[model samples]
Target: MRIWVVLAASALGLAGASRVAAQRALGKLLFFEPALSVNGKRSCASCHRPEKAFTDHRGTPRALRFAGNLRRNSPTILNAAGQTSFFHDGRASSLDAVIEAVLTSPDEFGSSYAQAAQRLGSSAEYRQLFRRAFAAPVAANTINAALVAYLRAQTATASPYDRARAGGPALPATPAAGAALFAGAGGCAGCHGGPQFRDGQRHEVAAGQWVKTPTLRNVAVTMPYRADGGAATLAAVLTDGYHRPLPPRPLTAPEVEQLTAFLEALTDTTSADHRAPAALPRMRDLPGRAVGGQY
Candidate 1:
C-alpha cells in the first residue's frame, strides 16, 4: 500500500510538470502567432526577436496603423519577469495589462481580445494545445496566463557576475576589477541593485522626465541605450552625463572601460529557449523566415 501511495505521488508530480511544459509550449506558439494582429503581420516576437536578446534592435519599433512611431525604444523582455512596472514610462502596472494595451493599441497588434479569440479559436491545433495546457477553452485569461508563463521563463541570470555572487567562481580579471568600480566609484548599484540589477523605480534622467530603470542583464545587445535610445553606445551612456544621481565623479577613460567590461559580463542569454515552432496553428501565409515576423 505504501509503495502504491508513493507511485501515485510521483505520478501527480509528473502530471504537474507536464502541464507546465505544455503551457510554455502553447505560449510560445501564441507568442509567434500573427493572426491575432489586425494586420496579420505582427506578433510579440516581431518586436522582441529571440536572437537579438529579445529586442528588435531599433531605437523605437515602427508603429503600423498609428501615426508615426513608438515613443520609446523596444526594451528587451529577457529577464523582465519581476519588474515593478511595465514599459518605459511605467504605464502598465502588470504584465497582463501591458499585453492588453498592446493588443488594443492602434499602433501595435491593432485588434481586440474578441477578434483575437475568434482568430485563434478557429484553429483546431490551437484549441487542442490550449486544452492540454489549461484544461480549458482558449480565452483571454488562459492566453494571458500562458503568455505570462513564457515571458517569465525568459530569464538569463547565469552570468559570470552572478556566478561570482553565488560563490561558484570568480569573474575574469577585467570584469572583477570593474565590479569593484560598479559598487564604489560607478555608483551603479544605487539604482541597479539586487539580484536582477534594477531597483524597479523611476528615476529622473532629464529635467522633467522620469523613466523606470531597466535591468542590465543583457544590456550589451539591447542598445541604443536609454528610454529614448538617445545614447548610441555603452560608452556614450557613461559620458552623456544626462542621468540624475550621476556617478560620484566623471568616470575616466580606464574607469569607463572597466565599467563597460563589468556591464558586458552581466550578459547570460545561453539558457533562454529561442526555438520557434515548426509551424503556427493556423497561420495561412507563413513567411519564408517568419519565426519572428517581418520585422
Candidate 2:
C-alpha cells in the first residue's frame, strides 16, 4: 500500500512537471510569433534577439520597435526575473505589465490585447498549444503569463564567477583584484552587491534622471552601457559614468582592465547564449501595414 501511494505521488509530480513544460513551450512559440504585432513583422524576439544576449546589437542607441526607436538602450532580458522593476525608468511594476505596455505601445507591436488574441486565435496551431498549456481558450492573461514564465526560465547564473563563489574554482589574479575593488573602494557593491548583482531599486544619476540598477550578471555581453547607450564600452562606463557620480577615487588603466576582466568572468557561457527554438512557427504578414520604428 505504501509503494502504491509513493507511485501515485510520483505520477502526480510528473504530471505537474509536464504541464509546466507545455506552458513554457507555448510561451516560446508566442514570444517568437510576429503575428502578435500589428504589422505581423515584429515580435518580442525581434528586438530582443536571442543571439545578442537577448538585446538588439545593431548598434542603435535605442531598441528599434516596429513603430520607432525607444528612448533608452535595450537592456538584456537575461537574468531579468531577478529584477523587481521593469524598463529603464522602472515604470512597469511586473513582467506582465511590461508585456501589456509593449503590446499596445505605438512604437512596439502596436496591437491591442484583443487584437493579438484574435490574430493568434486564428492560428489553429496556437489555439491547440494554448488549450494544452492552459486548459482554456486564448486570452491576454494567459498570453502574458506564458511569456513571463518563459522569460523567468531564462536565468543566467552559471558563470565562472558563480563557480568561484561556490568554491569550485578560483578566479584569476586580475579578476580577483577587480572583485575586491568592486566591493571595496569602487562603491559598485553598494548597488550591484548581492547575488544577481542588483539592488532591485531605482536611483537618480546622470543629469537627475531616474534609472533602475541593472544586473551585472552578464555585463560582458550587454555593452553600450547606461540608460542612453551613451558609453561605448565597459571601460568608458566605469571611468566616465560610474566614476562621475561618486567621489574622486579614480580607476587607473590597469585597474580598468582588471575590472573589465572581472566583468567578463560574469558572462554565462551556458544558458545566457541565445538560440531561436527550432519549432517556432512562421508569422503571417498583414498587407499594407506600416511598421513604426521610433519611440
Candidate 3:
C-alpha cells in the first residue's frame, strides 16, 4: 500500500513538471510568433533580438515597430522578471499588462486580445500547443500567462562578476579595482545597489523626467544607454546623461575606464547565446527615424 502511494505521488509530480514544461515551450513559441501582430510580420523577438542581448541596436535609440518608432530605447528583457515596474516610465504594472498594451497599441502589434486569439487560433499547431500548455481554449489571458512564464525564465545572472562575488574566483585586477570604485568613491552603489545592481526606484535625472532605475546586470552589451538612448556609450552615461549636480565626486577618465571594465565583467555570455531565438526575417523595410524623448 505504501509503495502504491509513493508511485501515485511520483506520477502526479511528473505530470505537474510536464505541464510546466509544455507551458514554457508554448510561451517561447508565442513570443517569437509574428501572427499576433496585424501585419503578421513583427514578433516580440523582432525588436528584442536575442543575439543583441534582448535589445535592438540596429536603430537609433528606439526600435522601429510595425506602426512607427518606439518613443524610447528598447530595454533588455534579460533579468526583467526581477523588476517591479515595466517600461522606462513604469507605465505598466505587470508583464501581462505590458503584453496587452503591446498587442493593442497601434504603434505595436495593432491588434486587440480577441484579434490576436483569433489569429493564433486559426493555426491548428498553435491550438494544440495552447491546449497542452494551459489545458484550456486559446484565449488572451492564457496567451499572456504563457508569454510571461517564458519571460520569467529569461535570466542572466551567471556572469564573471557574479562568480567573483560568490567567491568562486577572484576577478582580474582591473575589474576588481573598478568594482571597488563602484561601491566606494564612485557612489554608484547609491543608485545601482543590491545584487541586481539597481535600487528599483524611479528618480528624476533631469527636469520633469522621472525614470526607473535600470539594472546593470549586462550593462556591457545593453548599450545606447539611458531611458531615451541618448547616451550612446557607457562613458556618455557616466558623464552628461546622469542627473545634474553629479554623484558628489566626479569620475576621471581612468576611473570611467575602470568602471567600464567592471561593467564588462558582468556579461553573461552563456545566457546570451543560449536564450537567443531563431532568426526571423524582417517584416517591413521602413527606415527607422530618430525620436526625441527623455529616459
How many pairs of residues collide in model 1?
A: 0
**Cα lDDT of model 2 by residue, 92-196, tens digit:** 888878888988877777788899888777767778877777676778877886787688788888899889989889999999998987888778888888988
Error of 3 at 112 (Å): 1.0
| Model 3 CA lDDT for position 180 | 96
lDDT of 1 by residue, 51-132 (tens): 8888888888878654578888999988888877999889888878888899899888889988888777877888888777
Residue 248 lDDT (model 3): 71
Clashing pairs in 3: none
Off by over 4 Å in 3: 1-14, 58-68, 241-244, 272-295
- Return the clash pairs for model 2, or none: 66-292, 67-292, 67-293, 67-294, 68-292, 68-293, 68-294, 69-293, 69-294, 69-295
> What TM-score would you give candidate 1 relative to the actual structure?
0.90
lDDT scores for all predictions? 0.80, 0.74, 0.73
The order of the candidates by lDDT, greatest first, is: 1, 2, 3
Candidate 1 structure lDDT: 0.80
Which 10 consecutive positions of candidate 1 have the poorest summed lDDT? 1-10
Clash pairs for candidate 1: none
Name the better of 2 and 3 by TM-score. 2
**Candidate 2 segments exceeding 4 Å error:** 1-14, 58-68, 245-248, 282-295
Worst 10 residues of 2 by lDDT: 286-295
TM-scores, all models, native as reference: 0.90, 0.87, 0.85
